[model samples]
Target: MSVRTMNRRAVLLAGGASLLLAGCTSTSAPARVALAAAPETPKSPDSVPPHVQAMYAAVMDEPYPIRASRMHLVPERFWRQEVTDPTGEKPGSVVVDTTDRFLYHVRDDGTAMRYGVGIGAAGFEWSGRAHIAYKREWPTWTPPSDMIARHPELERYRHGMEPGPDNPMGPRALYIHQGNVDTLYRIHGNPDETTIGKAVSSGCVRLLPQDVIHLHANVVSGSPLLVV
Candidate 1:
């Protein structure tokens, strides 16, 4: 080929290579930018509200580690929050509204720390004035005689089920009593977060383990409990 034609061909090839490199660099730049700008996975408790963070920290700082596994992701609506007290009960009173599946811890400032709860199933529902006679941490589970009768599979646990993650009483329990008599009802923790905001228990009020840990730490024995 002619010298001039050879020079032109070399120039064209060099220009094409430059454009190809430029295209590759431009395409990769956006990918790098997207990775850098991508949002981070939110940190546990920290990404939650201030009050929730405080409660979460309190639970985790306990003598026994309330591990992350114990923390279940519940619906945003069911997450604990301080709302204007709807019930006119006196401060420090625990008012459980079965119809709404919410447990309210009345505060003096006209606000209540509301937590979602699971109430007794239709036939087993109970509502009346009661008091927290006592409290237990990692309480044992003893299936009642009637409960055992209905589900013979529970006969093995008739004696007692030791306190642990699998126990019906998740991390804490508050025994409800009418005067000196045991009402055979309780406010306790349940590991199943899906049950919250539903009526699926056998006359017991169930809260999430994290929430129960917070409530257990704050509520005192002898606290009046009104289930309505």
Candidate 2:
């Protein structure tokens, strides 16, 4: 064969081998495509339903004879509602479920008014049947001996702490008793709304100030109470 012809054949063979190799590489390799990232969704603030907002407005808008304090924003989950009665107690009875941090006020219509509450922590927890021996609005707070022993600074209030917005017992208090004996435990209001749905109180059950005010107005003395 001629040198030019041999060179042309060699060039053509080299070009064909390169094309074959490229085809094999393309067939074995996986395809890759770039994709746009998804946009992040903005989180919205928590809000209450229209009815609950109305109820909250009614409680907050009411005039207070005493010095009014700023209302703290509470989680919507703690809002009061009339739910089916789970306590099996007679109407007008109060049931406290410490584990769930809920207080149910039994109603005559086979439903209970449920309120979120802050319960006692650890050793401070108590459970048993009791009654609403009495109730008070803006009640005085007398530190129990045990509580005083834990914090000597409370000694000043050992006699009694005057009622005000700063008072631990916020707007109202329900004294619990058993058979005419004072249990020394109480269901009361706390100005700190964030405490609801928590277990951080000394021993007493605490509700939101507005909630306790509503409860105080409705609950009568000698109402049966069950703490479980």
Candidate 3:
């Protein structure tokens, strides 16, 4: 997925959007289809329109490392967690280290599975603990009033936007709540790859499509999350 710049000056495409994991030594190839056909793979930047390129440049300062292997498309190191046995905590365990832009799933042997994420900006961020009160697959997006006030163009979709490739919430979303109050934040998939490791979101933490799917499958409703 791609995001418009904070200044609304450019658009930035998310990482892992248009890539295919063939082999580490394989040459970069052009995208074979439109975004909807393959949400996991994105068209090569060079094949993207000039406007798209221009928009991407404004929102992103740099690009994510292109990792490839014969067996895996992305290296585990990008997310920065050591994988342990997945048996201990089948559910109800989460950790978000905001300082490092990582969210981890605790495992049985004391190790964790970590993923890179995009965090909220100043004045719109949240920390501390929350629970995964709900989970939605391809959730609709309803930009908050504050977000709409900041960007009037979003007013048309205030009610809710349908779930699909263009929707900001890609693949899955886990709502965070504190007691009975919904935190209005989520752990969801991002459209822009470069947002990871950067403070570019409103409040919710963003993850890659593949990683988000992986985590979504592991986490259950009412799970505890520690964000420090």
TM-scores vs. true structure, each candidate: 0.72, 0.73, 0.63
Best by TM-score: 2
Off by over 4 Å in 1: 1-65, 69-73
The stretch of ten residues in a row with the least summed lDDT in candidate 3 is 19-28
Model 3 lDDT per residue over 1-228, tens place: 111221121112111112111110000112122111111323354444454333223322113221221112222234434555232334347866566566778775667777777676544456655679988877888777766766677777779888766677776899887778776788887655655665666667888765676689888899877665
The residue pairs in collision within model 2 are none
Winner on TM-score between 1 and 2 is 2
Each model's lDDT comes to 0.66, 0.65, 0.57
Candidate 1 local lDDT, residue 21: 7
- The best candidate by lDDT is 1
Rank the candidate models, highest lDDT first.
Answer: 1, 2, 3
Provide the lDDT at 40 for model 1: 31
lDDT of 2 at 109: 90
- Superposed on all Cα atoms, the candidates' RMSDs to the truth, in angstroms, are 26.5, 29.5, 15.9
lDDT (C-alpha) at residue 212 in model 1: 92
lDDT tens per residue, model 1, 1-228: 233543344344334221100000110111111111112333453455666555544355444555442223554556788898876667888878766678989899998898978777655676666688999998877877777666677778878888765677778989887778776777887766556776667778888778898798888899887766
